[model samples]
Target: MEYITLNNGVKMPIVGTGTNTYGKVNNDYNGALTNEIPELESALELGYRSIDAAIMYRNEHLVGRVLAESTVPREELFITTKVPASEEYVSSKDATRAAIDNSLKNFQTDYLDLFLIHFPIENKEHLKNTWEVFEEYYEAGKLKAIGVSNFEKHHLDELKEFAKVKPAVNQIQINLKQPNKELLAICKEEGITPVAWGPMKAEDHQKEVLNEIGKAYNKTGAQVLLRYQIERGVVVIPKSHNPDNQRANLDLFDFELTTADVEKIENL
Candidate 1:
């Protein structure tokens, strides 16, 4: 897998697996939890090292269990989890600290590769306090890098007013349906990496275009979409339960998109 160097010099995998629905019943985001996650095991076996997890998903312990028990050593893994912007987590500094501590325990790790606020905190004080707690953990070496997810330009502006450390990444939805062009440019200008969550999503017509483009490279439309994102320096976390699809998701390093093909995709 390729890597992107964050502003703080931390290297993050350009491709990762999203675990929002992993270990859930029927692969539903709101489904009941299952005792095991074969998909995650399959991902590990397929050489996926970057894991994108969040507290709101409600399955950290199970995901962590799989990671901790995997044959892959902890050093080779790039684990990223987010803290929600809710009262239970961001109400106070101590509460935030406790939440992170619990996450560390659940993952059975001394340090996480990256940590992020799941959403923007509207209240300035709460946002400040939460960020300060994140900064504390980062300084203490518990969190290698800190960042925000689903943050818009205004929220980033608010963060800059009091932030000593710039955000290392801004995880957002980036697909043909929601190009998010402006925010992506902002991230590029500010030196923050953009992590695309729904990288495989595309309309049928768009998929047709991607498929046509993929034919030349002997790849699938989904692979084409993911390749488009990573080619432009965006990190993608595309998840799937099927082992073949999982293998296809990681089979992105073999091809490159032509400049005209990239423009065609951008215009789509």
Candidate 2:
């Protein structure tokens, strides 16, 4: 697996597994959750070193179980979880601190490689306060890198005004259709690495271009899509339950996309 350095100099796996695929807004972490754990296991077995989760996923316990039993050492794995945007936790600093503690307990790990504000609540003060707590954790070594997710340029600007530690990353929906050039440009200027979630879920029109490009490398459409993002210097987390898909997702480093091919996909 390849890696990209965050602003703080931590090496983050370029590709990882996301746990939101089992359906959001559900709490069946014991039954159906068991089915998804193997996909994470499969990812690890296939050499994926990063695993992304959130408190809202309600499956961190099961994720903890996997970590407890895996033969891999804790230091070799990168675990990330988030604080949700719901009012209950967002409105209270103590609640947010408890939420971080809960995630640590759920993951069965002492520290998280990265922690992010799951979503930007409209209230800038609340968001800034939450980030302040995250900054404290980061300084204390509970969190290695601090960041935000689903934030637009204006939200970042607002947070920056009172931010002592600038965010190291901005996780957002990035694909061919929504390349998010403006937001990405801002992150670049701010020294924040942009992580692309749903990197393979390209639009129908974009898929044609990806499929065409894949033929050159004897790869699949999804592989081409992921490669495109990586070439653009964005980290990606493409989720899959199938073992073959999980393995295939990481097979992006063997080829390169030309400037013309990249432009074709961009224009599509």
Candidate 3:
């Protein structure tokens, strides 16, 4: 798989599987937990090393169990999980610390490749305390990298006010529908990598455009969309339960989009 080096020099797989609904009944975000995640096993077998999970999904332990039981060594996996900005998890520094320790236990690993604040903590104190806990873990070698998700420019500016370590990534919605051009540019300016959460999302017309673009490369529209992001230094975590789609998501290194094609996409 291709990798993107963060500002802190940590290499993250450009293409990873998102586990928001994995191991849940009916694959629903609020569904009951199941005993196992066959899709995760398939992803691992198909060479997917990065796994994006979040505590809000309520299946960390299950996702972690699959990773722990997999044959892939801990070092080869680029595991990323998020901490929610809630009273239960981030009411205080000690609370945040407990949440992180629980996550490590759930993952069955001492270190995580990346950890992110799942959302923008509105309260300055909560945000500061949460970030400090994250920095503490990062300094302690427990978290390889720390970042934020769904952060706007103002939130980023707020983080910059006192952040000892700049955020390594800003995970946001980046697709044809929500191009998020300004945020992307800011990330580039700040040397923070952009990770696309819903990379495959596209309106019907946008999909048509992507389809037409894909025809030239003998790839699917989904492939073209993901390629567009990664070609411009955006990491994409496109989730799919189908084994074929999972394989297709990672089948991105073989082709390159021409400058004209990229321009056309940018225009779209």
Candidate No. with top TM-score: 1
lDDT tens digits, residue span 1-268, model 2: 7889999999999888888754322323343543346677788889988888888877888777787689989999988888898888778788789888898888888899999999987887688778888988999999999899999998888898899998888999898767788998889888999999878877787788788888989999899889988988899999887889888999999999889988887787
Worst 10 residues of 1 by lDDT: 193-202
lDDT of 3 by residue, 1-268 (tens): 8888999999999999999989889998888989789999999999999999998988899899999999999999999999998888889999999989999999999999999999999999999999999999999999999999999999999999999999999999999889999989999999999999999898899889999999989999899989989999999999999999999999988999999999988888
Residue 120, model 1: lDDT of 95
Clashes of 1: 0
lDDT of 2 at 173: 89
What TM-score does candidate 2 reach?
0.94
Which residue runs of candidate 1 sit more than 4 Å off their true CA positions?
Answer: none
lDDT of 1 by residue, 1-268 (tens): 9999999999999999999999999999999999789999999999999999998999999999999999999999999999999999999999999999989988999999999999999999999999999999999999999999999999999999999889999999999999999999999999999999898889999999999999999999889999999999999999999999999999999999999999999999
| CA lDDT of each prediction against the hidden true structure | 0.95, 0.85, 0.94
